[model samples]
Target: MAKIEPGNGLKSAESRKSLRGTTESLALTDGEGNLFGSDSELNVYTSERQTDKYGFIGGAQQYSEQSAENIPPEVLRQREAKWLDMLNNWDKWMAKRHKKMKLRCQKGIPPSLRGRAWLYLSGGKVKREQHKGKFEELDSQAGDPKWVDVIERDLHRQFPFHEMFVARGGHGQQDLYRVLKAYTLHRPEEGYCQAQAPIAAVLLMHMPAEDAFWGLVQICEKYLPGYYSAGLEAIQLDGEILFTLLKRVSPLAHRHLKKHKLDPILYMTEWFMCAFSRTLPWVSVLRVWDMFLCEGVKIIFRVGLVLLKCMLGSQDKLKTCQGQYETMELLKTIDTRYMQEGFLVREILELPVSERDIEKEHLASVRRWKETRGELHCKSLPRMHGAKAIMAAEPPSRQDLRQNPTIIVESPLATKSNGEDKERKNTKEQKNGKKNSSPTPVAAYLEPSEPSPLLKDAALLGSNQSLSSAEYDTYL
Candidate 1:
């Protein structure tokens, strides 16, 4: 993992000197005559300047070495061809061959095509078209001063080894700043969250500043609304839903976690919020993003289940952990070999769970949440600038909000008033007049349906299977 030097391929010293002079001229120097703005300003330089300074040569070489390795040239050409065809007639492809599109995504999108593919899948292109110059407008406007310092602190830490973001005032870091700052302005109530920095940085890797900004908007407002907000109520509710799913699908692991008092938020917050960017390997992270954009938030739950099955499915494996700290540590740094993107994704597709199942549980979880925490107060916006505008224009019904089937459904519980028919269940433990011995009544949620019959006999059975010899030998 050697650091790629700033100007590796420049053969002549004079040419390198000329490039350096151009970069220095384009850069905004500080009062002390230092190149680029002060750390607090998050000054952005031209991508041309960054390309010269950081040696981000074009095409596959621009990607990380690990990402570029082992990809075949023919495969690259084929993927690019498909991307071109889809881009030219997107509506036709989407309407006629959406299943084929999903299958291709599951195989993994080519790095070169990933940016365009993401825009198409997440509808960022349409968003970008709607708000033609919104990013530039937002970039020029002053963002909330409070968020500037926080955004600056996270810039360098995002992808220090990647050539695009390695330099102090590189294009990648600058675009990341613009996208985040625009988002803070777009939804002032949400402000800035540290989790969003990594997600935005990843987006900047694949697209230009404006495209990246719109993609970030789609992710925040559509893919996972209220996820990066101050209260983080949506993610909190999802954590509870994940726990509920675990109880039915992997009772033994669920009980073990309950016994040790391990909360899902402790480990799952990063996984769900960052979309596994910080947790999974680089290749796996890209693969997950491909499916995630096409399928929406359910991919997240499926991936979480796969990781849990790999880490905690076996009783013997759980027995080795001494305490909550040890279990958390193991989960955080689990063997990546077992969690290879292709195999884990296949397992996810095979799982019996569906969007319908997740929606039902989400509705049930929200009901329980209301009972215990009073009412949820989610912020609402008049209209999001891009892909989320459709959702913002027409307020969703109570059932639609609770179901939250697609990315179009932002702020599931965004409205102020709960319907008159909705009733909060009594969640308090019933007193049996025994000394703390009465069993608490768990919320009455439906039992998870049996997994696909093929999965029932497989080694990995819906997050609760005995460790196979191969898995144990490789991962344990």
Candidate 2:
């Protein structure tokens, strides 16, 4: 993947750049002087701040790739071998041998297989095929002016010190722009969210612009819907759910948070919203995302619980965090040990938070909030979560994916057209059957009800694209 000239890539693959009127700081002008894009995977560049392969700056005690590096080479080889086997038989593993897949995900998807594995786990490949050339079409079209400016300004800020983004308008940033702009075009209503950038950047690191774009769609729509939308109603609900689950995981941390009146959102907004791409160490971040893409949002809640437990779980640890401010400061400067892959993954597995627990908690939180703050700000309820819901809600057949569903937004407060009214009746009937079905105590909260897709597939979607069998087996 040769890096094209900074502005050249944008002009060819994305929109032309203009000097923005806003005075927002650009990461392109970092003190090391501008770096030209290169063909090398690791474009070594001198930096005033400490630079590692994963590109954590500012002398953070922990390096981004430290966790994977610490793994014994023999062990890595074994994991890679297992991943290769699993990748070759993905559908079989996903359906019949899910435990084997989960065990491997818990162990951590080998870095070499990360992107390809993610495409499969996230069902992004299916989405890309469904949409076809939609990305290219969106890329060529001029984006919404409002989103374009903000996206450009934020582009330089995303992993700016990293080799890929060091240039002013390099291929890295150019690709990032294409993904974000394509997203805005894909779902004009959800628009762009600031947290989506780094998440996109991380995906772009592993895959191409189109795959990355589809990966972002899965994260925003299937895995964590309503999270990146207007008002963040879904995250607010999850925040309450996290707090509720926290009580069982770490009572000390839970009690302290409640006593200090610390809203989970205050500390967790960045963590959960960014999917911990911004918080955890790079290797740990990748591990978390691997499991997250595999299992859905449960990985997120478990990660949050693990962090709170480590940071404030003990009386001794809470000595400094007696108040909200102190606890926040500690959260901001999390101990490196907590971010290590070995410790974090182990903790996540040990914690008993399940999809059922989350759904039950989600329903409770929604009802309680409806009474207090009124209904969700958005016109719809929160989506069903976890991997099962994602697969169920998203059609299994490529035929279904190709056929874009007619999306009719419904709200008690909003009026509906006659056609949309008919659609609403159909939707209600679906709800009455499976949507309102009673949940058993164990699997009850899967939010098994069909969720309105936050990012709808449109008529102007992509052209058919297929993943090569060999490429699917190995990212290399």
Q: Which has the greatest TM-score? A: 2
lDDT agreement with native, every candidate = 0.63, 0.70
Please, what are the lDDT tens digits per residue for candidate 1 over residues 1-476?
01112322122344322211122222433223555444344323333333421133222123344332356889877876786566555665665777787788887876656776787677666677666678888999988878876777677766554556657777778778888889898878778877788888877777667778888887887778777765566776788888888776677778777777776766677799888876775667778899888777778888887777777888887877758777777887776555665577778787677667777888897899789878887753321222223333433333332211111111223211222113121222224333434433322222111112232222321232232211221112
What is the C-alpha local distance difference test score of candidate 2?
A: 0.70
TM-score of each: 0.66, 0.73
TM-score for candidate 1: 0.66
Tens digits of lDDT, candidate 2, 26-106: 433333355334423123443445656554443232365555447788998899878767756555566688877877887
Clashes of each: 0, 7
Candidate 2 Cα deviation (angstroms), residue 439: 59
lDDT for 379 in candidate 1 is: 50
Count: clashes, candidate 1: 0
